[model samples]
Target: MNTESPVSRRAALCGIVVALAVPSGLVTACGSPAPSGTGSGSTPKQNGSTPTSASSGGALVALADVPEGGGAVVDGPGGKKIVVARISATEVKAYDATCTHQGSTVAEPSGGTITCQSHGSQFSPADGSVKKGPATTGLRAVAVRVQGDQVVLA
Candidate 1:
């Protein structure tokens, strides 16, 4: 016959307790980052300039996809998320979608600016600057380019 040490039993109990406390959705038994990208391994690229039509690299996104006089949040390169806006026929800009005040996602474009729904903070769509507060700092700008007919936010 064999006896288990008190420490061993205690560790086993602790593990069971932790397993119960963690949320089911937060735990990933596989321990892997989620699979990304189509199996084709092809991704749109930034041409170092903005694309003119409704496509980028080869992934085509319509300018109509963005709201008139506003912006839209889109999946950026490498699975990063970004906010893109069409300020004018010849002007477009992109910025990191996260807010500076408390790391909340910025609100979708409205009334010609992007506002933080979490704290009522406002920012200019053209430059991503704080138009009003609890956010004292401006939004972070990302490089934007046009490739083929798509607007690429790098």
Candidate 2:
């Protein structure tokens, strides 16, 4: 008779993996991933340009793309969508394109209002405030500024 019981192959491999992977911080599947591209693949190139960080003021879109009294939906940081509205010639405001009511994406600001086609939610372009029904809350504000002729994340 064998003096000691044999351990299964799966058990041995699990032990080896935990010993090696845990110590090196390679085991990350235990919890859910992060939001806002906070996970492993956050740094991505946009518009075929070099990767830029918010601390360094990343360019989002050209100023000409956004009309004087209207706004334009553009790709924001972490692959998120945002509405960049031109408040005036030298001022711009931005907000999350995701609608607060039902997680729908809001459209560009037209006639001085950003409209969500999903539920007819209208928001103010200057301050991201709710202006119509179906949406009780306004779109979330995104930190951004106009840098030269480019709209950049601030």
Candidate 3:
């Protein structure tokens, strides 16, 4: 009697889900509107002026917006939802926010780990590797680099 879509949960966080044979690249989403700003209810630290994501392939978020030891889930390249973690002062790491065990979007990194609230799964901020169970696999890596003061798609 309960026939819900498998990716229904994802749609809640993404507003749209593109499941066409599982593309290995950045999956476009509606986490936020493009050509404007970042998502997650937090404003990115601005410098002079903001440029559309097109100018940077995809600007995930401002480097300062992401805490030194924590992370934030934000609108990524092509509007995809991605989790970006600040590893060190100048180093960073990023991954597809979607939980590998299920389709639920993973939580923002905290305490040096990214957690899946849906299934008690945990992943490493260092490499997106699985550190806990319910998920035998690790999160997908989303290529990104710190450009100037922004974390951008690579």
Candidate 4:
């Protein structure tokens, strides 16, 4: 005899749809607007080739933009979103803004942690490591270096 309740069956179907839609790129959660050439279906542009708001003539952002022990979300190489954090006065780190769990753009780092609003995933700005659930994988690291007064892709 079928013992599955109607509510349970509906919930299961909804779960299936979300599972399929997320991986298939049919759904995108909370995040900043992705650049024109960068999306799940589109091929990401090569580094140093795509122009972004954060980068100008090879500079990703001004060092002043990132506060000490905090971070900012900037348009990154390949037209992708990147989170740049200032660990110390002379130290900085960068990571792909897309959350590993669901592709939602991570929020700016506060208290040395990056948070994903979509699913509440937390990541450490120090090494892009996941510190919360729903995201088992860490954020992708992006090479970054400080040049004079600006942050540039390394």
Point to the candidate with the largest TM-score. 2
lDDT of 3 at 64: 89
Quick one: RMSD of model 2? 9.7
CA lDDT, candidate 4, residue 125: 84
Local error of candidate 3 at residue 14 (angstroms): 26
Model 3 agreement with the true structure over 1-154: per-residue lDDT tens digits: 8797477666654543444425422244444344333342332322211212333346779998999989999976566678999999998888878888978999999998999999999999988888998998787776678999999876
Q: How close is candidate 4 to the true structure, as a TM-score?
A: 0.63
| lDDT for position 113 in model 3 | 90
Cand. 1 Cα-lDDT: 0.66
Candidate 2, position 101, lDDT: 90
Name the lDDT value of residue 19 in candidate 1.
75
**Over the stretch 1-154, how does candidate 4's per-residue lDDT look in tens digits?**
9896566775666566667764434333323233465544433333322212334347778999999999899987677888899999988888889898989999999976899999999998888888897998888777688889988887
lDDT of 2 by residue, 1-154 (tens): 8899899886677666666773333334323233445444544433222233444488888999989999899988778888889999989888878888999899998998999999898988878888897888767666678888999888
Between 1 and 2, whose lDDT is larger? 2
TM-score, every prediction: 0.58, 0.65, 0.63, 0.63
Give per-residue CA lDDT, model 1, range 85-106, as digits (tens).
7787646677777888998888
Clash number for candidate 1? 10
